[model samples]
Target: MHPGIIFFLVILGSVLFHIFTPWYWTDIASNWGGMDDTITLTFWIGGGVFIAVCLFMIYCVLKFSYKKDRKVEYKPEDKKLEKILTWATTIGVAALLAPGLIIWNQYVSVPKNALEIDVMAWQWGWQYRLPGEDGKLGTTQVININDDNPFGINLDDPYGQDDVLIQSDLINLETNQPVKILLRSVDVLHNWYVPQFRAKMDAVPGIVTYYWFEPNKIGEYEVLCAEYCGIGHYAMRGGVEVQSSIDYKKWLSEQETFKELIAKQQKIEFGNKKIVKNNNFLLNKEIYKEE
Candidate 1:
């Protein structure tokens, strides 16, 4: 059999495998269905190009292979073919990129009413923080993370007093609510990713990165770290539960707050329950100096 026949068989098998493959995207539970559409568009464009190129190669192989019956014809510089190939390649690339750019614009542009939630990642686990009734999260510092103060929330900041803290692996989100997740890291690089939500972002040390998604379905989803940070990277996983507004609020009310954690920390560290220098991180501010 000619090599062209073998190549044709391989292409056919690949196409069949892709079509019958059970591995594909999980069911989307977030408002990022547009992301799925954009990805599908990419797959279509790529597949078309792959098949077209393979067919062209096969045609060339079978038609131009050295044959004693046919004299060798040396032909180069087909301007018409060159123009067609150039235009085709340009159009394919543009089609592939345009949708992603459009989707990316929407991705970074957080909705005006989207709730701001903080996600802190470490080498091995996940933590979450949400504003209390004040609707504002307190400022945080890397220097403040300790046994009792795991979130590194600035205790001096009033807004963070009511910030709800979830030091557990499971979290609950309100259905149909758009949320802008603020990603942070204290140790090394990590990522906060939930496949069903169709959004993920990196957690870089000394800085914050973010992505947003709205959970439209009331279901549980597994969250995974998409980046490798260390040996524990594979086990750095969590979960999210999308629930009704009432149920979500109930869950939120049960979580501990930063101020509460500080108070508990005070009791544990100081057996007699005492207070100490409170402005370790905030004393340098001019406003505090004047006060």
Candidate 2:
């Protein structure tokens, strides 16, 4: 019946609505990532403080509120009170931030042996490249795209010799593997989003960004584009099937041998090209303008 109670009820209802809202992207808040525990701890501490303050205000309203026929009294703000509040707030902040900072440091410093994988996003599809037998990913660009060079890897670079290019349905397997994702986009911006893993990063054109995660559980997870780029943004979805170590090994071997066959065939075809077509070079100045 009171105005204050009515106002409180309205605010409570709004908060409940937000909590129970069905709209959600990834389970980043509820699920734990590399530094998720620290985040959750900070959230709980903040929630506790909010609840304590609200309860104290409620007590003041009910206990010291206006009463009829009572003499009004007012007191000046206390310096000791302000000092106590300041120290309490400082300690609370330190308690909340210290563990979070420590965990963040660990997250940033990944193990040296952790496998690195490259993810290139384009107009509508995603391309994944692995550092084949070697532990290095070669640089790539879109200008060199062709059937022979699917991932546009720098062939002149010696480090690219053992690099693995997986552009199609090659990552499906049966085991869990730790992988670090280095993201790049050829066109507009996109997001490498995997909800179950709680991992995501922006795929910006011209610049490279990345995130790493080891899927402990095995299942088929859908990767969604968190940022809308074009009309096909809603349809920008892919599948990642995490498999066991044995199945993953088997899959990797098959991919390697298959790629080897293709590479050999391409080399042979290029070498067999005769000089018969070399004399037909036309001197068309207008048609051959440089782009």
Candidate 3:
């Protein structure tokens, strides 16, 4: 019936449950395993504090319970205790914040050899652009966007002509190669996240964001939008397949270039116009004969 005993039991149960829980992180396939280390460090710091505070409360409850004949000591404050608490709190906070800062620095620093890829997110789907043999992504703007040119890649920019466009959600990358992913959003705000890679960044409507990672293992990773956007937000899913260099190259080679896509669209429109002109001519000739 004692409150102290119940507190002890609660702490014990929590520790046991955490130790025996089957839920753990997925296998990391990228070079950002340091992220896992940072998380573990945070868990230890937070969990340790929880356990210590609860145990201390239980001790006070048991030791100070209903002393019928004892007089309570009225000590205002302890200067030494205050100093110790202040320094301890400061150190704990710094420990938690320092690793995250270090990781963020590395996350934003792209290597010179890192291959650049553009990821565009919309309300219900994802699109990608890869630089062609030139290894440079073309300039893009929101004003140039249309049904035919979804990426809004500049038509007048010669550099954009050979940019490879992937209309589908699937993307392929070479294993053990570093890549810098540029994130953009057309309709609403979204986040490009893959758990196995342990890297994610937001795609804002007006500005571009980016993160870098190297897939050291060959596997397929599922991509999900971490931010809530609209009704189809739950269905907005995609994938990334890391493969050998040869297979990656083969897949890239099959993708359509920006210029090729524009030309194809023009041809289809031209054919439709010709058909309409022929139909009008036939109708006019028939009316003239009747008259």
Q: Which candidate number has the best TM-score?
A: 3
Better of 2 and 3 by TM-score: 3
lDDT of 2 at 198: 70
lDDT of 1: 0.89
**TM-score on alpha carbons, each prediction:** 0.90, 0.73, 0.97
lDDT tens per residue, model 3, 199-234:
999999999999999999998999999999999999
Off by over 4 Å in 2: 3-36, 70-76, 141-150, 173-176, 256-291
Best by lDDT: 3
lDDT over C-alpha atoms for residue 207 of model 2: 81
Please give the ranking of all candidate structures by TM-score, highest first, separated by commas: 3, 1, 2
lDDT of each: 0.89, 0.70, 0.94
- TM-score between model 2 and native: 0.73
